[model samples]
Target: MARHVLLAGIIGSTAYGLAGPGSDVDRIGVFAVDTVELHGLRAPRESYVTTRPDVTLHEAAKWCRLALGANPTATELAWLPPDLYETRTALGDDLVALRRAFLCAPRVRAAYLGYAARQLRTVERRLTGPGGANPRVAKAARHLARLVAQGRQLYRTGTVEIRLADPEPVRRFGERVAGGDLAAAYRLLAEAGDDLDRGRSPLPDRPDDEAVERWLRAVRAAHLAVA
Candidate 1:
């Protein structure tokens, strides 16, 4: 039978929503799959874990969900420098399949938005509370918060990721604010809704790109595997 294991990974500059000047260093990964295990479905499958204070299986599952949604960021994550991933008795094809469903952009954006909003509040409180206030520090603190708003849009609509404005588009817009600019930012982040739209536009043509190909391949493989 075949088996696979999660190894090191690099989320690197990937988590725009989680980023800050002194934000937590993002992570990347190395996963390994056994070819023999790939060939057999009845293999004892216990993966080896290097473990990190930062990475968790739940997050991995979350990534899978977002990727399945066709979220670009999540899709990009599954591909790290090959050196980081080491495959032995693992299911390479299976891992690819998981990434497909994991790329569910819509859901991932929602979850990431929540996380980013919370982080923004945490920083905001520290600066505005009585004995503290540094403009430069606060400016750096605001990046991820804004990105969260922007990312939410890109993820939902499948737009694109871009660096947000410095220091303050609008205060309290991080999580509490609803509608208007905040809402627009979220919509703009995931611009995929445009692609999925089959009306009033180019009437749906097939895409011919490596990223699209890889995603389709993974999803098809997964569906077949499941069936």
Candidate 2:
């Protein structure tokens, strides 16, 4: 499974330029199974997640489906900076080139904002639920900020910036929220909604399904040829 990885890259805080001391090095990858494997009654696993090394690998077809829906975490793999990549084949390069073909206005808007909403719930839980002042409250807050900002940028420009322009501000914002400034977090979330509502995105209303299909077929063909 590891050997079949087509594309994999560093992601999360490290790739976002927000890592500090003790931050985990997270990675995401795309892999392919032999085409013949799909002909059987049982299908091969489509995803693998590990906590020790903090890595996740998704099969090629599954990855394409998630990317087409504008899933922020899944979509980041194709947009990661060159230096962040640990594996890159010709097939991987093709996937990266088709990254934009996966974006669409409604999905981008819905998926990102929806993800941000979930992060907001986590922030509320960590802040008000169990232990007082959990450090994860800050982490959740930071991600909440990142998702909104990144989502807004993606909606407006049709591309995601993996590295933050100024991570320090976001870090500070997180600290402030962690220190019981919930109002600020709410404000940021509200701003995210407003930004989404105000834009006429350059992205089409839907992803380029034909392009994605062609690319997925190419991946399967490549795997079959190699096998």
Candidate 3:
């Protein structure tokens, strides 16, 4: 069955206001296939993609499951700037409305810190190479700092702030990493990760699964009806 693109938005550096003149435009979206495909012998694929600037389209059901888990990347889509939308149907707007329902303290901690850890590993690997510093090292440092900031903000405010309103901390951390002061960078990441356990975070312990499921059902029903 043909795929139906439900929502598409700019993501990555451009969406986060970190893009430079040479940066590529990255996009992420959610799509759905005919209901029949879900029940047929061949299950629908979980995602679609295009090259060039890079676009990824997640199948609707898959997108929901990821969002329910509070996957950082998927959840950030809901908070994108109004101008970044390439496509947004009524159903897509409904999906965006449910973004906050997916926020769970544990999930945010895991996803954000986990991603930061992975990036740190990448930076560590790059540091061992012949060249003093690579572009990826700087990029990874920025992402790690951003993830930590976002996670800390989410816990404190119960909302994710994709574009850091105050980027000084991340900027300083990035500069340290870029200048080969990885020890300082690691310390900052550790401090940020530890903050997740401080006091009682404002975010909920788990997502509102019932509400999210109800919304998903409505979308599926509406699509099936049209199909």
Which whole-number lDDT from 0 to 100 does residue 176 have in model 3? 76
Off by over 4 Å in 3: 225-227
How many backbone clashes are present in model 1?
A: 58
Clash tally, candidates in order: 58, 0, 0
**lDDT per residue, candidate 2, 111-148, as tens digits?**
98899889888888889887857789899899999999
Give lDDT: candidate 2, residue 49: 93
lDDT of 1 by residue, 107-211 (tens): 444445555555455455644566554443343344444545455544444343333343245334433322122343334333423432321322122222345
Native-referenced Cα lDDT, model 3? 0.80
Better of 1 and 3 by TM-score: 3
Which scores better on lDDT, 2 or 3?
Answer: 2
* TM per prediction: 0.39, 0.97, 0.93
Task: Report, for every candidate in turn, its global Cα lDDT versus the true structure.
Answer: 0.40, 0.91, 0.80
TM-score of 2: 0.97
Clashes of 3: 0
| Candidate achieving the largest TM-score | 2
